[model samples]
Target: MTPAETRTAGTTPAYAKGRQRREEIVTAAASVYADAGYHGASLRAIAKRVGISHATLIYYFPDREALLAAVLERRDEEDDARGFPREPVGIGGVRHLLALAAHNARHPGIVELYVRLAAEAITPEHPAHDYFTRHYRDARDYMHSAFSAMAEGGHLREGVDPRTAAVSFIALMDGLQVQWLTNPDAVDLVSPLRFFLQQVLTTSLDQALSRQS
Candidate 1:
């Protein structure tokens, strides 16, 4: 039988109830963590927010780290649903990043959660250290491939190295995010990114013109 069918066919009513309750706990925990940061959030407090007892919360998550992982996973699922990485090729990837920044502006809580956890996860002992590590590595690789494709397509300026450009682009995005988080009124994330891309594309055009001249 299919997994869904099996889940409904042989699953006990209590097990189904428990599964639903666990989803509610995860949703509550995500909001708590987003507001308080992982280090400051408490399981008991999350339980209170969900109107469940502390023991019941523990029965589902067992520990803070596990709950944090679940929250991050849920965030990833939401990001995927939002059409993140909709364009994974060449300059389209750069456009996709700008679009993501625009999307982030509407979700301050999720942005705050990411910034707080990413800073904390710099420590090797942090529960999210490995997660952040893999996250950066994957992001860099994707950006690098995108830049490489642009270079191969003759869209990048002369003397521009794809790998270096990718790293710089990622750094620019992260730096802008920090600035925007600190002073949302002063920092316009999408505009700055558009200006950067315009500069890059203009330079590429100039290089092509010089080559033909």
Candidate 2:
């Protein structure tokens, strides 16, 4: 989108109200979807949560597919808002993810929803299969670039391959989520990630995060 267009987005009263209504519906839908998986969530339920009529909800999202897509899009927007950049910059990328994990710790329902949907979307025919595919691919590549940058800058540990570390880190996050879901009180999500990064990088996670701040 053009910068000029972005600056004008949702500026008018009617357009802003429409956009606000859409965001409200998406937020409510996300909550409902988090409580109940997409298959179990219904438009009526989402509309009720948003205090809107079913017809109004349909007006905003023509169908279940559209609403589900919006929920996923809003989720990525939330992640971006949480500081998980689309293109992570060096070790700071790792720092952002760890910060995200910390954020996730306070929201187990969101973490559970993510884990559930990621598993559900493994099938080729799943509506979000492509989304998950690109999501993981982006995650892997994000970390790969970070590790690669560290290697070039002499911050990566000796004998560590960026590709391998990147893949392993993603796997670790997925596994940690599963464990944390089952034992939220016992598990320490952010620290495990911090430890993993410490093993791979010569720079302290704190030092890098502070620089980002």
Q: After superposing candidate 1, which stretches have Cα over 4 Å from the reference?
A: 1-14, 83-87, 203-213
Error of 1 at 5 (Å): 11
Writing each residue's lDDT as its tens digit, candidate 2 over 1-213 gives 654465444332245678799889988887887778788788899999989899999887778888889889888987778766466757777777887788889988888789888887889998989999999988899889988987888888899999999999999999999998888788888888889888887778677657642
Residues 78-171, candidate 1, lDDT per residue (tens digit)?
A: 8678655444666656656777888888877778888888898999999989988987876787788777877787677687887877788777
Candidate 2 — worst ten consecutive residues by lDDT sum?
6-15
Give the whole-model CA lDDT for all candidates, comma-separated.
Answer: 0.76, 0.83
- Pairs of residues clashing in candidate 1: none
lDDT of 2: 0.83
Best by lDDT: 2
In candidate 2, stretches whose alpha carbon ends up further than 4 angstroms from where it belongs are: 1-14, 203-213
Rate residue 118 of model 1 by lDDT. Answer: 89
